[model samples]
Target: MWLMWIYRILILNHEISMASIEPIILGLEGTAHTAGVAVIKGREVIVNESATYFPPQGGIHPREAAIFLAKEFPILIDKVFKRLPFKIDKIDGIAFSQGPGLGPCLRTTATVARAISLRLNIPLLGVNHCIAHVELGRTVTPVDDPLVLYVSGGNTQLITFLNGRYRVLGETLDIAIGNALDTLGREMNLPHPGGPHIEKQAQSGNKLLTLPYTIKGMSFSFSGMVTAAKKLLHDHSIPDVCYSFQEYTFAILAEATERALSCTKKPSVLLTGGVAANAHLQTIIQKVAQEQDTSFQAVPRNLAGDNGVMIAFAGTHLFNTGKILSVEDSQVKPRWRTDQVQVGWIE
Candidate 1:
């Protein structure tokens, strides 16, 4: 009788293992100045899409973008869903950015996601915007804990993990790195979103115009450097300024990374966000890591820019931890911090 019971128990376990696995959640990322969506099955992203909007004149036009997102999101969501092998209803829950982005854009995304949850009678999970950005990239990048320098139009500076959360070890005291680059690029008559343009120009030129590289304690400042670059450009060639600007900015970034590494006593580093796409920055980071014999990880170009896949992966992690969101929970936050999040979330 005892032997027969053991056989039955083993057979039941086999049957359970054979049952189909369903996706844990659907992730929506609208925190980007550009909008995006990603579907995740556990920790793996299945479909991710982003629509980048270039301002007609200068800077992001909030009303224009809100209208754009409202019009474009449904189509993009449909496209992503169609690519999925299974039905959306099969998803265990829905996740959307809760805060830390353009208010109008955030509301538009939240409204749509909430409507989906209400219509489908499914639960929803709200995510912190900036936390999602860093976490999503970190999940895929190999860099463990040395430091994360996130430079973009809206944000810049140093990040480190501590007490089970990512903390802002240091950051820009003024304008973000991407903004400075773009502003300088504009002065050079380069196109909008000019970080790439500056980098391209620098490849053909040598550093002629010098710029300041500042690191005050754990934080750094970019306004002075931006001012100096603009002044120098009138007397110097554009390419030369571009080369020197890249060198100066990257040097400050590398110095901050090294400082963070030493302070935290960690040996791994990760580069993320839009600015991480710069080849020059990558070279500098790799060089510094090598000097310290530290490990470095950078997100691939596809994942570097803001996209939905990171949201999906983040949602997947949160879902498995029982942090699921309900329909009543659908809300947007314009300022959410990464370190405020509690760990022990899903794997």
Candidate 2:
């Protein structure tokens, strides 16, 4: 009878220990051309894997990209599971990028997330893609509260956290900075993603040609600059045009960021998103941070781009804060703005 009592005690302790373990979340990202999957145990990222679809000729065709994500997501998810120390059933919740992204791509990812959540009988979290970027930047960097400069193919905004949500102080009035770069890249016959190539050519460019500098209040427009830069290509070398393009655009961004920092008095400035990979942008923003007497941080190149890890981290926050959603309510938002999300976990 004493042996039986000891066995029961041991079993009870094991159950309690299991219950005390931190929750694990699986995240999926398929907002555009990239399909990603990652696993996070509490705040630690266990595995992150992704595959990007490159258009054969021009920009991403939404349907084609969706098909690619549909095919690649399973493979990436399997890869993540293989690298994980625990089994698939051990996942406590599922999180996915809900929006704002291509409709087909968002649907594909949401379907996968729903399937996983239902199969495992776990909570489902629909995370905002833009908020995920900011959250991940905060998690990996030393910044507590920051003035965020979010730049990417589809978005360009100067954001700050206030009250219960991220507020946009400034944003692009026309095309996003990354899209403008890619458009210019298409004009130059460069690859689909034009930012890196433009940066490369800008290194050798000596001439700073004329380009429109549009800044109305806190918002800026890149479409005019892009058009003018394209026109300059006929009379100037690619390198010179690229150089002038970076100088003008990055300067505009730095100016806006500085203004926001000064106005908000944020202790730090964080640069994040796909365009955050540009060294020139980083340099310019760093300078602005120094001038404002605030610390500066840029998302690491690997995490700067869209990935599943950010989504997972954001999802973990949502799950911990009781933000789980039912499958029926987990719908995609193609035009979800940055300020639309209620950032309940920040406070």
Candidate 3:
């Protein structure tokens, strides 16, 4: 009781005080091909809007995506303000995804966030993109001390909390699973963002072709498997190859997640990232969690993707916890790791 009181009185952080007294926050996210804006009041998202760049031909070109974000952000910001019930002056703070993403995308989002923070003179917070995803799962679900499986186009890792840090217990050594799938799709001459297309094909495939399964210690490797699948694409049916590819890849992640759970013994397993939208991977992770006698969680399909809501949600927490940044310090970090964040709100 005394400690709690002392913490409340002794903690002298302007941002944390503002968060506790004020209830509204504006958040921005453009860590990759998506540019978004969100308004968070207390724990609920009052406004969540995003514009994604989908290249008609190949994968996302960084420069093109940056240009697209530059064009679309104004429209998205306008949409949020025009639709909001309250005035813009009601917002208490501003937040943006600061790092662990593509350089151009991160810069575009950060620049806007900085401009807004200065214009409004509100407290500014730079959020971690990976940490934002985990925060989204927490906002929409009931999970505490969860072991997280974060998979996306640029990242793949099994993470959990211990000793005041979100630790990376296992990760991909080379390309992330999402990128590997996209690359495979490119190799097969399929469209960009091949995850959905691959999922569709894998459903019809009954055959499971033999592919290399690489798991080092608790980490995952998909580069070799992708190469081998490219070779077999000549003889095997596309559906069958896609099926085996998913099975192998998803199983590897499931196994690594299971190991993380066993090591940490956390009661919950939260599956997130763009790939969490996959039905097969969800089933596999759910099964692993159930078999381990642990709880399972997945963000709703809408919240499963990258958006400003997660970044905004994380911003709210960080502000309350006294993590405010100056405009000069609020630069983008394309290679920031999740484990480096000091999680002050989570207990």
Better of 2 and 3 by lDDT: 2
What tens-digit string does per-residue lDDT give for candidate 3 at 149-244?
A: 988887898888888878899999999999999999988888889988999999999999999999997998899999999998999999999999
Q: Comparing candidate 1 with candidate 3, which one achieves the higher TM-score?
A: 3
* Top candidate when judged by TM-score against the true structure: 2
Ranking by lDDT: 2, 3, 1
Predictions ranked by TM-score, top down? 2, 3, 1
Model 2 / residue 107 / CA error / Å = 0.4
Off by over 4 Å in 3: 1-22
lDDT of each: 0.77, 0.92, 0.88
Inter-residue clash pairs, candidate 2: none
Query: Which candidate has the highest lDDT of all?
Result: 2
lDDT of 1 by residue, 1-347 (tens): 99999999999877544322334567777764677877777556777877887776677777788888888789888898899888877777778887777889889889988988888887787887656667766677665454777777767757777777778888888988888998888788888898999999998877566567788987888889988999998788888889888888889888888877778767777788789888889989988778777888777878777777767766666666668776665667776766677765522
TM per candidate? 0.90, 0.95, 0.93
Give candidate 2 regions above 4 Å deviation.
Answer: 1-21
